[model samples]
Target chain A: MPRSAHRRPAAGRLRGARGLAGWLFVLPALAFYAVFVLRPIALTLQYSLYDWDGIGPSTWVGAANYGKVFTDPDLFDSLVNAFKLIVFFSAIPVVLGLAIAATIRRIAASRLALVARTVLFLPQVIPLVAAGIAWSWLLASTGVINQLLSLVGLGGVTRAWLGDFATALPAVGMIGAWVLLGLCTLLLLAGMSKIDPALYEAARLDGAGPWREFVSITVPSLRQEIAVCVTVTVIAALASFDIIYIATQGGPGNTTMVPGLQIFYLAFSEREVGTASALAVVLMVLVIACALPIQWFAKDGNK
Target chain B: MARRVRPGRSGAALVIAMGTLAAACAAPGSNSPQPQATGTSAVSKAPACGSAPITMNGYFETGFPLPKALTTEFTKQHPNVTWNVREDQFAVITQNAPRVLADNPPDLMRLPQVSELVKDNLLKNLDGYATAFGWDKWPASQLEQLRLGPGGRPRGEGSLYALGLNMSMTGVFYNKKLAAQIGMTTPPATLAELDEVLAKAKNAGITPIVQFNGGATGGLAFPLQSLMAAYGPTGPINDWIFQKPGATIDTPSNQQAVQHLEKWIKAGYFQKDVNAVDYATMMSRFIDGQGLIMFNGDWESGNLDKQMPGNVGFTLMPPAQQGGKRAAMSAPLAFGIAANAKNADCAAFFLNWVATDKRAREIGVEIGGSRPMGPADAYMPEVAADKVTASTLEAGADIAKDNGAMDFIANATGAIYAKSWTPNLQKLVAGKQTAQGLLTAVQADYARQLEGN
Candidate 1:
């Protein structure tokens, strides 16, 4: 007992030294995070309470900017548009990704599968801005899309997809879907690889069809992956800026005005730093509100 | 359990660090000096470049080749002076100006909208440099747009805060071949004549006007503003743009102008897919003879001349009536020195040299395709009569002679262009907005922004 008690003190000392070394190793990253992320967040919170133009003296107008975020129709409408984007940015990608992943799983050993995987994932590799520009050209009134439509005798319905009031937002959302589909598919495919073949074989022995096996085993196994995809894509939809900025720029009569672009216009274009900061805070809260539920639901599903 | 404990500990640490940072740094703009009106006499005389080498830092708009050519020439002329220049898109410059002026304070920067920067005390008062270099002796209209009254109100009537690199004017550029096809020899001198030309061009199956209305550029505003000038006096328009008290763009005359523009839109004078066309596309379509005319500025003259030499013609927007005075959106390519610029003297010297030097004036004409701002009788660069640039320059002179120059309405506020005018114009193109609604909405937005400021 005396030897054991003596050893415990040495072990405690050793643990203390290791902890200090570990902290030292991570100190640089911690400092960077504090400066870049934490500091900016704190500053944004502080700035949200003021009426400042980013330059000039600021006035303390506590919560007025936040009030504007909710009360202003333009601002509120932007939030709604962001929510609408989730269907394309999150839901469509996830469903389509699952289907693609399931199909690829059957032909996983073939060379064509490799090519399919690479082709499907190409959108994920392109920069968002380049993707935006390319998509904008393809969607223009006289662009390749219209050319193809005309060839197929669909020319009468052809219009400027990005410049139309009814189609601008959906067109932008479709671009989002295209960019995220690749990422979601690759994630789901990776999840599908880990599923036990035995489970599928057992389903087959039970007279289950391909659809039933997919629904019963593959989906249950991918709960966490789907949740991850939902969380990431939902965040992308809510915080989307680059593609919208390069493509529509919240134009065609503000039909595609998302909160991300709205905040940029407020702070940078309008010089309304206070309102921009307030909108940013609200967006962050909304993202957290969205992501936390998915995470909790995923954890519950796991149990 | 250990991992959970670590995250909690880290969260507390982050809070502590953030609190420390919040305390360490003062609120942004808290320490900034309250903007006070500086007297004209408070400016200091610009010193000559001495033997010591000076490397002036400049922030310029990207894609404009004139600034680069000018800087290179300046360096060659004065071996002791060199340039370290950075370039960005104009929109990016508008966003970055405040920070750049506050932190880095470039010696020279392309000032797109100077009123806000001036009100923030980020721009240097150039009255003394103007006096020293006799810029005051130049045409009053030349420096009018660059001046701002106290607190940046009534922009054309106070201390000079910036100088023009060159004077740029916007007008109608027509495809000569297309115009001939429509049997138009001389440029239209009246609105009725212009309509006749447009209808003739349309009947001949040529696009009348190729004005872009896509994305963020809103090239439609160019024609809209020109129409505004055609139907009314420019005083109220300029007043509204300069944020003059009681000024409104929703005046009766301007409404008439908008109605005229709507008539053109309804008459199919523009391309069917005009809303989808961007500035580049519009320019390309115009160059390819897809359109008979394009509402653009002299900035395209140099390029257009090179692309379709002797195939394009420039003219002012015709007046509402025969022989009536005409106006154009004529403004300077304004550049200013930062309030805290280290090489203010050298920057001022370079600006002066750009205007007065013979080689500089020639470069300004050949490359910039804009009139160099100097004394009314200053040496003017001669160009071939057939070049599109010459016609544009001649139009600029006519604008100056009539004292009919006005600022682009897009420069009224930093956000007005993108947030208000652009969307409203897009809505107009989409048939979702009316002319009256467009003006009212824009005025309301302008008033709200002014109130916020």
Candidate 2:
């Protein structure tokens, strides 16, 4: 009885030592996360409660900066624009990714399929800033798109796609779609490869056509991947800065302004650090509010 | 299960520890005035740099070769002095200036907007250096824009905080070949005559004026400000820009200027894709002979001399009526010393050399493509009469005679250019906004920014 009791304490000590070792192993990563991520978030929250020009005196103006974020037309309009971008950045890419993944599955053994995947994924390899610049050139009034339209006897419709008010937002959205489509397609393709072939065979035996098999077997099986794509792309659309900054800089009368760019201008250009921090905090909440639902839906689907 | 719970407890402890560290690092209110550094009086009165080797740190605007060229020449002439320079785009400099000036303050920095910095006590007051170096003897208008009154309100009236490397003036640059093709033998002398030339160029199927309205740089503001100078006296405009009490940009004369710019837009004189063209693309298109005229500053004089040679001509934007007093957007390429600079004497000496030295003045003309700001009798560099630089220099004299120099509207506030003017001008080009709406929107934004300040 004494031996067993002594052994119990020894085992407990062993377990405690193991725990300490595990924590030691994670210390570096934890330190980085604390310094880079958590600290900035906490600082942002603190800054949101004050009025600062980043260098001069700061005044406590609790909630006034947040009030401006909701009441200011420019700030509010940027949020609306980001939400609208989700249609192009998230919806179109996801839908197209499903279609492309299905088609690639049919030709999985062919060499053409390899080339197709590579070509479609090419945009993902290019830097977003470079892609934006190349796209701007292609969309300019005297660019290849207009030249092609002229050649097709549709010259009357040629205008600067990125410089027109009605078209600028859609144009920027299309660029986002172009950049994100490749990522989505590859992710969904990977998920499709993991789906049980028996499920597809069963659907086929039920007299289901290619479309029915895809609807009944493929999509249901790839819910997790679709959820991931929506979450990532929605975040990308919301946090977008580099592409829009390079292409339009929130111009053509602020048609393409997003919260990310607006926050940048408020902080750096306007020197309104408190308002910028407030907007940043709001953006973080928005991202979380959007991501949580998708994550829950994906997790709930597993049950 | 016990192990997992232990990690969770440790994670919570780690977060608490991090929160405390961040709270400790959070800065307290920084409004308390710093102690004034002494020994500046002695340095300001020094006639020449000491023989000891000195490294002057500088921050300059990228894409402008003049600053770099001048620095290199200064180092060569004064063998004891060297430089460590950093360059960034003008927009980036504007965004980074406050932080850069406060921490890691460069000995000399390109200051695009000075009032806010002076208000924050980030810039060294140059009044003592001005008196010591006899800068007060120079043309009053030359140093006018560099001075700021109390509280940094009403610029042009108080202690000087910066000095110009050279005087820069904005005017209309025309393609001589395109002008002749449009039946123009000389530069236009009146607003009506300019309109006739623009109409003629349009009828001849040439882009009349290729102004950039794209992205962030909004080149449209150039012609818009020029038009403002043409339609009205420059005093009220300066008053508005200098932030005089009760000053407003919504004045009737300025409204007339906006209307005139709108008329030009409606005439399709600009390229259909003007709003899509960036600054670099506009310069390239103009250099390729795609446009008859472009509104630009004298800083491009040397560049045009190399690329298009004698095929280009420059003239001040003509007045509203024949023989009316002309005005132009004229300001210095201003540089200032940081409040915490370690080498104030060396920097002041360099500024004086850039103005008074004969070789330095030549570099200012031949390299900077702008007139050096010095005494009224300072040495003038010789350029061939037919060179574009010569015409720009002559226009400088005309602007001086008219006492019609004005600062760029973009410099009115640090954020006004990016937040208000660029967007409004882009809307104007897109046909989504009216002239009056543009003015009103900009004025409202200006008021809001000032209130925040």
Candidate 3:
């Protein structure tokens, strides 16, 4: 007991030194967070309670801006539009990713396989703005897509896909799908590579077909990767700006107006900074609300 | 290089293009003037930038050419003074204005739009400088257009907040070869005649209009405003645009103008999938000789002169009735001194020189592709070097002489174009809505904005 008591001070000093070093290491990141992240968020929160025209001195409007976010039909419509994108950005990509990953797992490791894998992952490396521009050109009325269609004797179906009210939102969503599909497939394929080859062999001995093995082994093993893809794609769907801004700009009669674009227009063009900030806050809350359940499913689905 | 479909605006290349685009939403004035409110006059010489190690900060868009010339002259006059200029996208400047004005601001700012800046008191009132420089000698109509009431409310009768280096005019730009093919030997004398020309061009299997509505709606609004000015009573149109008391945009004449646009769209005069085509594509295709006519402002005159010199001709949209007033849309590329400008005097000095100096006026016309607002005799002969410039100047002179100039309707509110007009116009063109429906929607937005003010 006497020896332990004597050793306690020395141990306490060592522990204190380690604690100080840990804080020292984290101080730079903490400072950055306070200034760049927390500070801006704090300022935005304050601005959300006002009726400022961005340039003019702000008038205190309390919770009026927040109230508007809830009551304005356009804001609600914008939120709904953002959610609709998740079908294209998250659900379809993850499903198609699984299928592609399963199919690629069976292919021999030849040069053709390498080339296919590289092509599948290519979209992830390109800048999103460039991708959007490419897509816009492809989808334009007289663009290459229509030229191809006309060549195949399907010219009657050709239309301005991005500019038509009926197709604009879906057209834009499909661009998101095309961009995200590559990422999802690559991630799932990486996960599939990590699965034990012995498991598939054992399943085959149990009279399991390829589909059964895939459903039982591949799907269950990729639970975490699927979650990650879903979370990332969902956030992207909600917070998308560059692609939409460059491609459609929430136009063709506001059929594609998402919260992110709406916030940009309100803050910059309309000078309604207060409302823009309010919408931003609402969007943040929505992303969290939408993401939490998907994360939960990813974490618990295998069990 | 052809224009690009820039996310916000085409920026520097479209500086003059956007200049006219916002003129509608940025009505210089709407309210009745306060009786006997006139700036006092005092003739003054060029401001001296005293020899000191001074750095004047400035912000401008790409196409504005005055900064280099002004800086060079200023530095030459005062060797110790230097200009530090920052060129940015128009959208960036506009979006960052409030924060920029509140924080560290430049000495000079090419204001995106006036009403909001004036309301926010982000600009230094230029009346004192106007009085000091004997600017009262300038035409009252030109100066009055710069005035705005307190908080930027009721434009046109308060204090001057900005100064324009030069003005721009909106009109029809025709492909001369296409026009000849369509039997339009001369410019149409009236809107009805122009309609006939469009039909003839369509019958000839040539696209009559080359328009781009994907990125911005200003392309659509140009012809719409011209049509309104041609058929509608000038007073109500101007008053509605300026946001005058009891003004309303849902007038019968405005409805008729919308219907005419609808008719044009229905007659297949415009390109198929115009809403999908971007500004750059439209200009490139037009340069490629794909269209007979395009409604645009003179800001593109320089580009037209450079790209397809002899192939294009310019003319203002004619009035609906023969011998009726031939009104056109015209406005200036305006700049204002920041309220917190460190070198307010230096900025004011530049504005003074740009407005009153003959050398500056010559530069404004000959090189800048700008239309002159002063006397006809004041125009530079050097402008004749560019055919587009010569024709635009001629049209400007006619409009100025007859007082047939009007501001853009969108200038009534900053949100009018993006929030209201753009979507409605797209819907109208798509055949999903009526002309009256479009006007009603736009009027509601305008009223809602006014209520907020």
**What lDDT tens digits, residue by residue, belong to model 1 across residues B81-102?**
9899999998889889988998
- Cα lDDT tens digits for candidate 3, A1-303: 123433555865555454444455656676566556665676677778878766545677889998998788878889999999999899888999889878877783767767777888888899999999999999998889899999999999899998888989998899898889889998999999889999999999999999999899999999999999999999999998878888889988888889999999988888788899999999988999989998889868767
In TM-score terms, which candidate is top? 2
Off by over 4 Å in 2: A1-13, B1-12, B19-21, B24-44
Interface RMSD of 2: 2.5
Query: For model 3, how does the per-residue alpha-carbon lDDT over B1-453 read when each residue is reduced to its tens digit?
Result: 232233333243244333433433321122212222224332134444556788989888866565567667667756788889888777678677666765777888877767777666667777878777656566665655577887677776778877777777788999999999878899999988999999999999999999877754536877888889887866687677667778898988888999999999999999879877777788898999999988888878878888898889999899999988887887777788877778877788777777666777766776666664443345464666448878988898788777877777767787888788878888877898798898888898899888776
Model 1 bad stretches (over 4 Å): A1-13, B1-16, B33-37, B40-46
Give the Å shift of residue B1 in candidate 1. 12
Docking class of 3: acceptable
Query: How far is B160's C-alpha from truth in model 3 (Å)?
Result: 0.8
Models sorted by lDDT, best on top: 1, 2, 3
Task: Report how far off residue A244 is in candidate 1 (Å).
Answer: 0.8
Best by lDDT: 1
**Residue pairs with backbone atoms closer than 3 Å in model 1 (clashes):** none
Model 2: lDDT of residue B120:
76
TM values, all candidates: 0.96, 0.96, 0.90
Clashing pairs in 2: none
lDDT for position B17 in model 1: 82
Candidate 1 at B184: error in angstroms? Answer: 0.7
